[model samples]
Target chain A: MNSRLIIANIIRWLILLLFQILILRNMSFYNMATPFVYVLFLLLLPFGIPNILLYLIAFGTGLTLDSFYDTLGVHTSACVALAFVRILFISVTVRDGSDEPEPTLGNMGFKWFLLYAVLCIFSHHITLFFLETFRLTEINYTLLRCALSSILTLFVVILIEFVFYNRKVR
Target chain B: MRNLWIFISRYNAFFFFIIFFTAGIILTVRNNIYQRSVTFNSTNQVVGDVYKNLNVLKKYINLGAVNDSLAAENAKLKTEILSIKNIDTTKETVVKDSAGIPQYTYLPARVIKNSITNRNNFITINKGKADGLSAGMPVISPIKGVVGYIQDVSEHLATIRSLLHKETYISVSIKKNNAVGSLIWGEGNFDYRKAQIKDIPNHFKLSLKDTVITSGFSSFPQGVLVGTVSNTGISAGENFKTIEINLFNDFSTLQYVYVIKDKYAQEQKELEAKLTNEQ
Candidate 1:
């Protein structure tokens, strides 16, 4: 990526991280579902940004969140898992030699972006809640937390996507 | 050997993923102990400062609710003070002087960060070791209701494991009969407003809305309000009754709290340690 694009990405990462920890961290539905909008950073990272770089970035983002949430590596594990899911989903759906644009609602189209987001986010939430609870007896509640949080996160992500419709970045 | 090298090169990303994922798992496993050191949490210097500053802005929005709660507390304390003064201040003063420094001192602090949605919830406050606060200092909402105790302390911040957490248990007694039980979390932990009390003997009468207060056995000073008994059932153990209670503190809107400093905590701890060592 060009230096200008790199700077833009860094700024976006910081903004999303702050927004997630400061605002969304405090917003929970009946102490069950919390919208994790910070994952947008990983979801929209420039395509073909080397898998290693993507995972490392995801780990850092999750660690920052984990510090604020006092959740230790729970978010880190989930973020790394989400990074893997992101690469796998993109590879399966987007042809390897095809023109690559950043994954956003405007560029990827609604249907494709929705599928990509749901698949990736659910992977993150499921990993997060399951690792957090870490018990088989509470599987039902854990799954409920994952599903509710994933839906809330996806809704917020889409709402933000619509509000800030990005032009196709060259 | 060439094919093996090419295979490793091709899957280098997966190897990196495995390495980081393993580290994450290790951290998660050791997280309970990791919290002892205040490095990787909201109490960390940078994160604590951010929360402290952000609280300045958020406090404005919450002023109305804070006012209402404080007003109620004021009214209650007025009547309580009137009654205490009428009883015999001179005699109480004599007793208090003989007792040395007050057993528990209250250190006022602001709640910079709180969480209620997790199975294990923690609250971060702006007071820390510099203010003579330390781990195991009992924290309570104003008007002295049970909240939690300090779990870890840094220079200017401390994290409290709230009663809403799965592991938090406080010794409590029914006000009517003085029957003792342990207050614990879960049985709908998502409903942060509720907690469960177990080990009350089945023979004791437990009615709905019976007031529960701290029994002085635990770290808390005696008589701090816990909650009212909301439900009672047969505990798995034959002799014990499972009781549920409604917590008073709405952790969602919790802004300020008092961390209790016990003058006798260190001395008592040393005595207990010596007893264990003797055994």
Candidate 2:
């Protein structure tokens, strides 16, 4: 990757991490819908980044967020799961021959971006909420929280993409 | 050896993922109530410092509400003191006895962090070992109701396993007849106002608004108010009654709490241990 691209990605990582810990950490709608936009760091990683590096980045990001939330390992487990399956998600969404450099609204069409974001966010939320609750008796409540939070996170991710990366069309 | 090295290099990502995922799961289980592991939790210095700083800003926003509650608590305490003074003067002519000596003392603390939504919730307080706080001490809210017990304590912070936690159980009884039972926060008990009291015999005459208090068999003092019985029922094939209680202290916005230190706890525990050994 070019030095400029690397610097931009680093900056983006810091901004997302700070935004999640300082602001979004305290923002929960009706005690149910908690948006986790920090996953965008993993979602927007350059396509074909080394799998080992991608997994490490996801684990590091999740651990940092977990420290702030006081949930020691729940976030790390969910983020690693998301990172592991990210390649499969990309293969399913991207065309067989299209060599998309990244999963962004500008690089991929809006429909593809939406599908990709929804799948990733849902997986992350389901893993996170279930692990956090860790009980079968309250399955319905956990499911409701997972679904609502996933939707809220998806909205925030899409909004960020549209506002910040709108001019960089592929 | 070359082929083995190539294989390891090719699938290193999978290996790393498995290792890290297993570590995360282990940490989760260790910190859970089952293991009761005190390490690797948010009570650590780094995370606790960040939370403490954040709470400083948030505390200002809730200053008005906190002040109101404190004032209400003060009014109730004044009445209690007056009544105690009246009883003391009336009993001055009676013979003094060792039983009259107080057995418990209170230590005040502020709740820096708390959660009611989780199945196994915990509250972090600002007092710890340095402030004469230790594990197994019963904690009470600003009011008379029980909050929880101190589960883990560091130098400057302590984690309380709140009453809302599923694993929590306290020996409790009806204030009128002294009908004894146990209080538990059962599954599907999402209402912060309610808790479950099991083991009360079905034949007892239970009525609405009946008061429940700690039985003094456990960490808390006898007659500490728990709540009032709100609903009661008898499940099929069971000989006990299921009583739902509406707690007096709200857990959602708890600010100040008092830790109860039993001066005679060690002596009682030693006697119990001796009895067990004799058996």
For model 2, residues B1-279, the per-residue Cα lDDT tens digits are 999999987767667779878877776666556323433443466698887888887788889988998898889999988876788675565433377756788999988999998888899999999998878899998775999989999888999999998878899999998889989885456787789898998778988999999999988998898999998665557778778999988998788899998888888989999999998
Q: Model 1: how far is B32 from its true place, Å?
A: 27
TM-score of candidate 2 on Cα atoms, chains taken together: 0.51
Give the per-residue lDDT digits (tens) of candidate 1, residues B70-165: 898899989988988798755665334364766778888999999988889999998888999989889999873889989999878889999888
> Which runs of model 1 end up more than 4 angstroms from their true locations?
A1-170, B1-43, B89-100, B235-237
Cα lDDT over the full model 1 = 0.86
Number of backbone-clashing residue pairs for each candidate, in the order shown: 0, 0
lDDT score for residue B111 of model 2 = 88
Question: Interface RMSD of the predictions, in order shown?
Answer: 3.9, 3.2
Among all windows of 10 consecutive residues in model 1 chain A, the one with the lowest summed lDDT is A95-104
- Kindly list the per-residue Cα lDDT of model 1 for residues A51-113, writing each as its tens digit: 889988999998999999888999999999999889888878988766654788988889999
Model 2 residue runs over 4 Å out of place are: A1-170, B1-43, B88-90, B93-101, B235-237
Write candidate 2's Cα lDDT for A30-83 as tens digits: 989999999998899987678778888888888898888888888988898888
DockQ of each: 0.24, 0.24
